[model samples]
Target: MTGADEALARDALRCGELTILGRIRSASNTTFLCEAAWSDRIVHCVYKPVAGEQPLWDFPDGTLAGREVGSYLVSAALGWNIVPHTIIREGPAGPGMLQLWVDQPGDTDDTEPDGPDLVDICPPGSVPPGYLSVLRAYDYAGNDVTLVHADDPRLRRMAVFDVIVNNADRKGGHILAGVDGRVYGVDHGVSLHVQDKLRTVLWGWAGKPIDDETLESIADLGEQLAGPLAEQLREHITPAEVAALRRRVRTLLAEPVMPGPDRHRPIPWPAF
Candidate 1:
């Protein structure tokens, strides 16, 4: 259950030889489960190539990997470390976002509703205590379901992080329950959008007052957003996107509450 050494993981991601084990068949982009080896250390990492990124009308082209890195920077700035150590570096497939892989418990899905129907129609009965149902819809299989997220403190922290980043996709599958009993968030390529496109599964704190400690964290994030963090982000993302992130941080600090979902669409597809 020990976490991977960040320095070792980052070094491997940067210079180690990557052996692609196989492609993880995600809906949006081509993701590879890879092993990076250098010297005596080996690390497992997720690799998302810029060439494999699907075009989105809203976000700029070939910028997903940078957004992924940007999310990592923001996660680090907030002192949450919810995201794994991620970096943008050249790979066999040109440039990509390489991140350390998180190993989750085998029974992490114990609370997940079984079958397509049960999964799609996430009934309140299926939801564990201390979680809230924020979304309800029918899956591609046409089975009705509800989307629920934990009201746990860790998830609440991520909710605030997502709000600050304007995370566009936060599916249930994207939330990782690490073997070390830590929660991790992955697949941030669709996050940090310039628009108010905060589509996510974490709506448990909507309209709720953010706790004082969490607000302090947000305040620290806001200050960093205006200073060195924005400068660092500029090296990866466009000036416009950096400015947009700054705006989001400012607004969140001003309100200090869990904002509701978008008026049009609130949840990501294939909510698994």
Candidate 2:
């Protein structure tokens, strides 16, 4: 993270309707899952506001600033159906960004045939299944993707939009497959990489030809990017940053079946 990123994070945190849920110990940066008040609805939110400087992890280029910019751009440009809202909150220390949280789907039944955490891909957990089930509850795949995809092409567009955004952590759990079958992506704290930092399992479409609807969406985005959407992003990111994002959009529109991580490439360790 750079100085600009810190400043942006501080600004976002200081101004939203956010209530901290708790600190997430697994992330490298200071992260908190919170609740965001958006209009009449209160949505689950995630905040990653750092109090002090942290080492930069650049395999995924772009600062935290870039990720924030990417989030705003995706929503405005693609209407990817990513949760349509935001909450900027203030901490005793400084500001933080708040994202609309999608409620976790599935029975969440704590009992009955629970499985290993999505991250625990191994020869079955050696310990009692309880430990594995507990851990896997929040793991990827715990949420149901099929239900969300049931009604909307928007869900798939969001997945593709994430690929274009270079989101490195679109884990299964990050996607909320609502009872209404609407899908929302969360934990976009890592996105807008200048490099190929995209490490997601949605590559089920990798190597496949891009569909027409997907291509038109990309085109639609290009038209919108030059308008009000671009102006909105101008407030938080520099003109250069915004331009780079536009360039990325152009690239995606040009080559629908863009290259992603190599088919069998290993997942990047510690996604956030």
| Most TM-score-accurate candidate | 1
User: Per-residue alpha-carbon lDDT of model 1 for 22-99, expressed as tens digits?
Assistant: 899764698999999988889899999988988888886438888899999999988999999899888879889899
Give candidate 1's TM-score: 0.89
Q: Which pairs of residues have clashing backbones in candidate 1?
A: 120-145, 121-144, 121-145, 122-145, 122-146, 173-272
Task: Report model 2's TM-score to 2 decimal places.
Answer: 0.65
Structural similarity to truth (TM-score) of each candidate: 0.89, 0.65
- lDDT for model 1, on a 0 to 1 scale? 0.80
lDDT of candidate 2 over 1-272, digit per residue (tens): 24564345444443435677787776567777776543444445566663532546553343453355457657656655574344444653366555544444354654432453322333223433322211221236455221111213544566577766767776655656554556666666666655556766454444556688778877887787788877876665456656766777787777777454564542443322
lDDT of 2: 0.55
